[model samples]
Target: MGWIYLILAGCFEVVGVTGMNKVIKNKNVQAYMILFTGFIFSFGFLSLAMRTLPLGLSYAVWTGIGTVGGTIVGMLYYGDSKDWRRILFIAMIVIAVMGLKLTSS
Candidate 1:
């Protein structure tokens, strides 16, 4: 349950970041609203997940998910650089996040 909440938090983090990008590019009020809501829900879920997960482990995973998800979002939707090196690094982050999850008790 805690892990579920953490995963949801990470997803919301991606939403917030993507919203930020949209707001910056187009100055859309709806994008700003999404950014605000996403952050609020992200933090709220993260706090709930902390009830069972270790602080360090939970934080690392949450940020890892956000980093990877945001990078993909940028590439797919925002036309970010799609260099091989960037993709490789994103893959590395995914591996590390999985490793952390597998090792956690």
Candidate 2:
């Protein structure tokens, strides 16, 4: 259940970041709304998860997942670079996040 919150937090972070990009370009009103709502939900869920989760571990997992998620969102939604090296690094981030979660769990 806590892990579910963390994953949802990551998804919300991705939505927030991608919507922020669109909002910055003044290209999407809906994305702006999504951005605002996503941040609210992400933080809310993270706060809830923190109730039972260790601060250091939760923060690390949250940040790592969010970073990878944001990068993928950037690439898919904004046509950002998608080179092999970048993908590999993102995969590493996922692995690290998973390792941390597993170790901490």
Candidate 3:
């Protein structure tokens, strides 16, 4: 259940970041609303996840997942950079996040 919450939080983080880009592009009220809503839901799920997971492990995973997810979304949807070097760095972050979970448990 906690894992589920963490995953949901990560997904929401991605959604919030994507919505933010949309809001920036069009500068519409609806986009801002969606972005704000996504942020609220993301934090809600993240808080739920903290109940079971260690603080450092949960935070590392949450932030790492969010970073990677947001970068991918930006690259695909917003025409952001997709260079190999950047992708490699993101992969490292994912590995580190996994290591934190494995060792913290």
TM-score of each: 0.95, 0.91, 0.92
- For each candidate, what is the lDDT? 0.94, 0.84, 0.87
RMSD of each: 0.9, 1.4, 1.2
lDDT winner: 1
Scored by Cα lDDT, where does model 1 land? 0.94
Residues 1-105 of candidate 2 have per-residue lDDT tens digits of: 787887788778877887787788886779779889989988988888888888888888888878998898788877889999999999998898878877885
Which residue segments of model 1 deviate by more than 4 Å?
none
TM-score of 2: 0.91
Checking candidate 2 for backbone clashes, the offending pairs are none
Candidate 2 local distance difference test against the native: 0.84
Q: Return the candidate ranking by TM-score, descending.
A: 1, 3, 2
In model 3, the clashing pairs are none
**Which parts of model 2 have CA positions greater than 4 angstroms off?**
27-29
| Worst-scoring 10-residue span by lDDT in model 1 | 19-28
Expressed as tens digits, the lDDT of each residue in 24-100 for candidate 3 is 88989989987998889999999999999878777888888899999988888778898999999999998997787
